[model samples]
Target chain A: MKNVFRFLYELLIGKPEPPMETPLYRSEIFPDVGGVSLLLITLVLVLVYYYVLNHVMRTARFSHWYHWLGMLLINAGIAFGYAIYYCRLHEVTPDSYVYWFAFANAFYSALFFFLFSLLLKWRSYNAARTPF
Target chain B: MAKLFIFGIGGTGARVLRSFGMLMAAGVDIKADTVIPIIVDPDTQNADLNRTVEMLKSYKRLQGVAGHDSGFFKTDISKLADMDTRGEGRVKDAFTFDFGGINQSFKEFIHFNEMDPDTQALVQLLYTQDNLNSPLTIGFKGSPNVGSVVLNKLINSPELRFFADNFRKGDRIFIISSIFGGTGAAGFPLLIKNLRNPNSGLQNAGEISSAIIGAITVKPYFGLQTENESVIDSNAFITKTRDALAYYKNNLHGVNGLYYIADNPDTPYENRPGGASQRNDAHLVEVLAALSIIDFMDYQDADFGEETLFHEYGLRQDAPSITFEQLYEETLHRIGQQMVKFQLFAKYYKDMIREDAGKNYYKALNLDAAFANDSFHKELRHFLENKQWGYFAWLEELARNKRSFAPFNLSTQDLNLLVQGKPVSRSFFNKGITQDGFVVRLNKEERNLTSEANPNRKFLKMFNHVTEDFYTSKMPGI
Candidate 1:
């Protein structure tokens, strides 16, 4: 799972920015941010969209393609914010590497959101055919 | 399953058949497997007959796509000519009985000028100048005397022979006519007489003579404007009804079930004797009369006794306007839920379908393309909302007529308040019957109807199931 996250994030923005923080970035930051935002949060948001708002709430109001896009963008924003907060919590060197990693996380979160949507949307009552 | 052949005679017959078509389109449970409506009118230009014919044609088209088991247009209504599967008969391929265009005067029709002097003298004494000069094209002109002579030739007509040829042993017959009008008053007894006559040399003479025949003789329900030049006089409606009743008491025979329905005239209609301009607003009497057909079909073979069964309709209460509450349990059980469900289906199609284009149910069926291009969708729209003779127009006319039958609150957009006196219950947690709620039900129903291959059938089945669910859950009291 950790290697999968590393490959996905690094594909968008190459390896960690500053040379001094490469070990910390590879060991903790890459896996932590990618696992939490790209996999966990994106999956939760997609479930919330397909199941919570549509099925549980019994509404088709938010089942449009644009609505799905809005959920994806929200997951991306959360991924960006969580990366910055996690970097600060670790007291990492205040450099552009943290911001670059955040950007990479945000981009990968969108891809994860789309992938999760395709897998989960079929069982939804109202959003089954949505965004098709 | 037995087939029913309904013979709708004259203008009142046409109007009643229109209401009957609406009921069938609303998915009312009619017992007959097939209903063949044969409209008998010499006035081919009569607006009421033309409208009923058009509505029946549209209904047949919808029934072709909707199928017979469920949904709108579930009842099977076929033209009499279509029953000629052998393709050997000369019956016209139309709903109305072909009169072959009666374009001459009544005098010319009877060959009065060629008659001998003594026979002419007897004819002159029996008929006045206006009666003789009355054009056959405009119909009997409230003169049953003229109607009787012209309609007596009906037994020999090719249509009657064709009907006899196609009729089977278990098939039944129903006749709808007005007791106070020209063509119906004369045609009803003549038709019954011909059908009951064992010697009538039609193909199925024995079967037709012994058929379980039912007839609804609509009495005077609406008056007409007094036109000095017009041959019809509204003041004479009661007098004519009294005379017809007296004649029917002795002459009318062989009917297993005879239904009598009438209403007091509250508003006067324009008295155009005949033709396209002589359209009358639909009355509650016509709707009730249509119900008699359904009621007649409800009976079994053993239900009828040796005597001719007689029936009369009465409301639960005498009110100026009617709602579902005023209807008896039997009437409600027959049509109430179906009518409400159909109204909801129609209102949704008219008011909410365009906005619901984003709904999953809408997309799953690809309704956008179907609505724009498919003939089934177009016919459905025309059936529900056509301004002149659509289902909604029928409802509007019924409401506008005196002793109005206004069961649904058609003016309101709120689905909860649709049924008059029966508002859908709501709670703080559960908002009753919102547009969103309708879409949710529709979306859920779409998944259940996936096995239906045809898109049109799927669309109708989805709405039919969803509306039934709403009726069951939301409007329990109804």
Candidate 2:
């Protein structure tokens, strides 16, 4: 147990050690907020995330792999940890409905914004075509 | 000889031409007048062009391309036509080439020495002020009124062609302009598209009518701030540039590679100067783009390093007030913000596919219309995969080396060091690219380091092959 806690700490700092037990430790960190707040935060996060991710794929070509890869790894670590916490660590554990509804809501909202940004400017929120 | 008829006389087009002009003035150092350029601005070049040529001319002609291509108290584009029609040597000479192009791609270049007696006499008369800009019997969408008259008179008839017969195949001809305003933006594309029917550029010389063409377009820097912009929208201009490229692809029968320039303008104009100069650095943008196109198309070499258009393009100012180094540093900060955004997106991927399904996630990002679809994931993977023709390849080729799309590579720091007139550090560089350097920005302090004579001759330790004396000469050949 001591060794497993040490492994999880190392994963956060970006070390060369194996992560054999860290995933399990991370499972305890997820918190499945029951009711409306969980849904609201998930919805907001999904839309914001979708917009940003697409922007990176389009323009991140300007720098190095670490610039992008480092960011991706950190995000995945947090979200996946959150997933484990919600499904296994908190409350009586989430049913399949929790996973399905949360996932569908996040994906749909994000996708809508992603398409909208392409057709209009976000700053002015103008609907005019970019002319290209 | 490949003759490239570039269309689009806006900021994008003019900046593209500057690269070709700089190469000509700088002289790439290969013997035999290699490539020849013919300029056809619907009017005259703008203040930014006049100033750049003024600077480059010092290395080649300092006082500027001189008598006719003069800067300071310059003549307007409209009056040049009157001068050309009136046997005014400066105006007529401004439009004609003194020698055969380094290559014979321009079909109707109006070669004078090779003509027979009667034809020579006709050619001379055709070249005179009264003939060249004569109006056309039947006008098109953007015809120059008197210029058309002169063109019809010189070509003898609207049906006949002069440049077509003069051009030979595979000759590299570079057409340059800036698309934001004036002659370059309006005239460059017309000159390129018109060449297809064999009536463009006076149609005066030989028998080969058509030749292959290529283009290098330029986009303004992200901030692209301008104080004196008349009718400009930097965002709309970017979109128009894309449409123009698509237009070239759809309209022009044949064109090879469309290179781009996304750099700051390299000029001395600042808050003090107000001689009708383009504040957004549009001219410098056009030239950098032109240089990239020539290197990619003419040389078939494409591993260009990151170039910062704002800071490194000129050695004029002592220490620039607003250079590309700061701009690049800011750019990286923006990229960092984007990383946070993408991390948030991982949640969407989580519900859509399994943890092991890297392939499915990538597909959903690239090709799919829906966020969770396979195409979108594929696209994300394609970028992450760093495939041969993926986004990385494009970024590496165009932006990683220089903020501007100039052929040579100089990081933002390197650019700063060069501008400071400091020597470039080759110790770590000689050992090979450091892993961390993959995202370095170019600055202006390293200005004259790349052009110096090395004492240790240790440059080979850094670059596999050095970019030495690779510029074309200012002297033209027939």
Candidate 3:
């Protein structure tokens, strides 16, 4: 069970063998649990987002254009905040900020968040349309 | 479309008509295409009359805007004034005939002072001083002597004439009145007499008089709260009813069908002679009386015979209070299913709508603004929340009575627990109605309904469709 949990954790955060020796970021000040903690936080944040979305969809028209826009903005903000925290944890160099990989992380996180939120909203909409 | 001219006379008449209107709103099948209700009461300010009139107006307005697509509130109810366009156009635009000159004492109404000494002596011999001095504003106050005189004039008025004129051959007439009351007891026999009178000088008097007439004589089912010199007494109800029935047995005419409904006077209402204080609770007996009219309409023309057919209301056992289980199989099939369906519909609107509104079911129907904000929606809510005779109050009273019709637990705080055909305690365990089961059913039912862009129209049609399907599936026998 411990090995399975570790494998699952590693699969979510990427291969554990990879070193933080890239040009954009290097491990120095942050503890070893930094990567796991950040991943856990992201998981918690996603779960909380899903919870709220479920609640709002129960009684509110969350699929309206304005509501979708609002949801997109919130998800983007969360992803960007997490990206900034990830960079700060690894202590990215100021000169490496302009690197392609530097912004790619944030872009990928935002895309994932956007797609996940969209999927949830669509599911609720479908559930609503389906009669008992 | 044949019309059913329902003459609701006095307080009891008004209450029965109120039940009929509610049943119509809930989509009960009344074979008539149009219902023309003409209320006859001298007391214009009577609470039961006013409440019934207001409810009828709401039903009319709601049915008007709801269009023809929805099955609920499908029965067309047009005012007598609206139907007759041939006159000088001096229409009152009201359900009740104008009783303008009846707000005076009986003596004043007859112009006692204008009579000579010998005529006055004759009038004095015919009527006692109390009968002559009695006011006609509140009502006859159980004095058929006064009511008979006052109500006889209405039969010859232009309103009755217009009613007789506009009435087609296939159309029908039904009179609702209480046998123990002054106005109804006096008016029922008088109205029938005028309708059947061969010499009555009115357009199409013969055809009108000979129309297939049905009348419901409501025996005194309730009593007054307290005894007072000026008010009606409970002790007299039995004697009055017996006497009235005997009179009907001897002199009743024209009516081809008659329905008799009454309940034991276990619960007495406040002792108000007439006016606003006469507002009574909705009883199961009144609902049964309304159902009788529907039953009458369901019959074929060939069903009528020369002899008048008589019917009476009954339950499974002579219990004090009645539950849905206590009803007879036929009664359950006729009234139970429809009652529960409408009860579920009302429960969904009154309790579960807010939470369910956020579901995809509403969004798919393009109801993002919430159908609650619509004017028709507001009007319906207002109708159900009416102070005197709202559906909620009606059901609550029915459940609280001796023959309780407590099919749903309306007192629960949880919207999820609101289930039809089951008690509140058993709502959780009931099949086809779990916490989320109704919402799902609503969502599914919306897909099946014919789409209407109007949210109010869609809301009513969807509820009408879903509740019917649900109740029918859940309790097929009912």
True interface contacts reproduced, per candidate: 0.86, 0.00, 0.20
Best model number under DockQ: 1
Clashing pairs in 3: A59-B358, A131-B444, A132-B440, B320-B402, B321-B402, B321-B403, B322-B403, B322-B404
Give me the runs in candidate 3 sitting further than 4 Å from their true place: A1-132, B85-88, B116-122, B364-373, B401-405, B413-435, B448-450, B475-478
* Position B364, candidate 3: lDDT: 67
Question: What's the residue-level lDDT of B90 in candidate 3?
Answer: 52
Model 1, span A4-56: residue lDDT tens: 77677677777776777777877888888888888888988999999999999
Output the better candidate (1/3) by lDDT: 1
CAPRI-wise, candidate 3 is: incorrect
Looking at model 1, the pairs that clash are: none
How do the residues B1-478 of candidate 3 rate in per-residue lDDT, one tens digit apiece? 5899999998889989998998888777788888999999988888889888989998898888776557577788888888867656554778987777577999998899999999999989988787888888888887776799888788667688788778888899999999998899999999999888867887777788778999999997887777656557778889999998999999997689999998888767778888767777777788889988998998888899899989998878776656666678876776666667777777767766776554656666655454545667777777777766677877787777655656566787553344434533334445454436565555555555545776677777777776776666655544
Task: Give the DockQ (2 decimals) of all models.
Answer: 0.85, 0.01, 0.14
- The parts of candidate 1 lying over 4 Å away from their true place are none
lDDT over C-alpha atoms for residue B457 of model 1: 85
The TM-score values for the models, in the order shown, are 0.98, 0.33, 0.79
The C-alpha interface RMSD of every prediction is 0.9, 14.8, 6.2
lDDT string for model 2 (B292-371, tens) is 54344434313222321121233223222323233234322322222211211221222222321222112212213433
